[model samples]
Target: MFFAGTVKTMLPKVPSTSGKMDIIRPLAYVREKDIINFMKHNEIQAMSCGCPIEAGKVDSKRKEIKILLQELETKNPNIKQSIFNAMKNINLDYVLGYTSGNKSKG
Candidate 1:
């Protein structure tokens, strides 16, 4: 009886109850149509980005925009249109503001 008790104690314990299950909290999935609408509202290409990060005197502002665009794309592959649109807007903004020895007002 002692050997049997020792063996029993060595076994892992489990809950006797049934019907206990794990629940997962999921993020709300954005729809493609909603993503397109967001792009229209933001005046950006749905998947557009103008910033590229490079070593040696890299522009931090451009890097930031690039990171934001990357995050948006990584988080929602369904929003490719919005990503592209945002990129187009970035290019337009740059073109309108960029000039030699002159600061274009936003």
Candidate 2:
């Protein structure tokens, strides 16, 4: 699951409900295809950033995420299972932009 959109402000400091999730903020106006390749190379499954953060934090975030993954590996042997559970435990009801086809009639 990849999330790319406009976030009005810096991300809130939310506690990690599961394994460490990488948030990549591309630092420039790059082609989406190129960004996808970067994501693939880095194994990023989720993101929480847009143009504002992307303006000057691409390299830093990339390195930070790498370090985070490495630290997780050294600290927890069940990192894979933690990430899987994080992805699986998403509560759609709390998702800001989520919509369901099953809208109730007014």
Candidate 3:
């Protein structure tokens, strides 16, 4: 992935899982397939910290996070509680830790 010039003038490719940009990231280099997925996950984790549960979606700010988590969990049982706990989570430090490398938290 690469971004040149100012953010306004730059066009970029997806970063690897480590968030490192490259000039031409082959499929082998991208451990996460796409970087947008990382952005989405980060956004979701942030939203999870700032909302309340409601019918089918979060009631406070972002609904996309809740919907995405639901869809992800429905497809993967192991990831179910990650989203479940994110709803009740009130600590940014904990969520940031989970979003990083520690696998068990999420």
Q: Which stretches of candidate 3 lie over 4 Å from their true place?
A: 1-61, 83-106
- Deviation in angstroms for 106 in model 1? 15
Q: Give the per-residue lDDT digits (tens) of candidate 2, residues 1-106.
A: 3234522322334335464864544543354557789989999875666755455455566456556767997889777568656655766566666434576322
Stretches off by above 4 angstroms in model 2 are: 1-58, 93-106
The Cα local distance difference test for each model comes to: 0.50, 0.57, 0.47
What does candidate 3 score on TM?
Answer: 0.21
lDDT score, candidate 2, position 15:
36
TM-scores of all candidate predictions against the true structure? 0.24, 0.30, 0.21
Predicted candidate 1 versus true structure: per-residue lDDT over 17-67, tens digit per residue:
473753332322454467778879988764434535354255675467556
Model 1 has an lDDT value of 0.50
TM-score of 2: 0.30
CA shift at 35, candidate 2, in angstroms?
A: 20
Question: Which window of 10 residues has the lowest lDDT sum in candidate 3?
Answer: 1-10
Cα TM-score of candidate 1? 0.24
Report the number of the highest-lDDT candidate.
Answer: 2
- Clashing residue pairs in candidate 2, if any? none
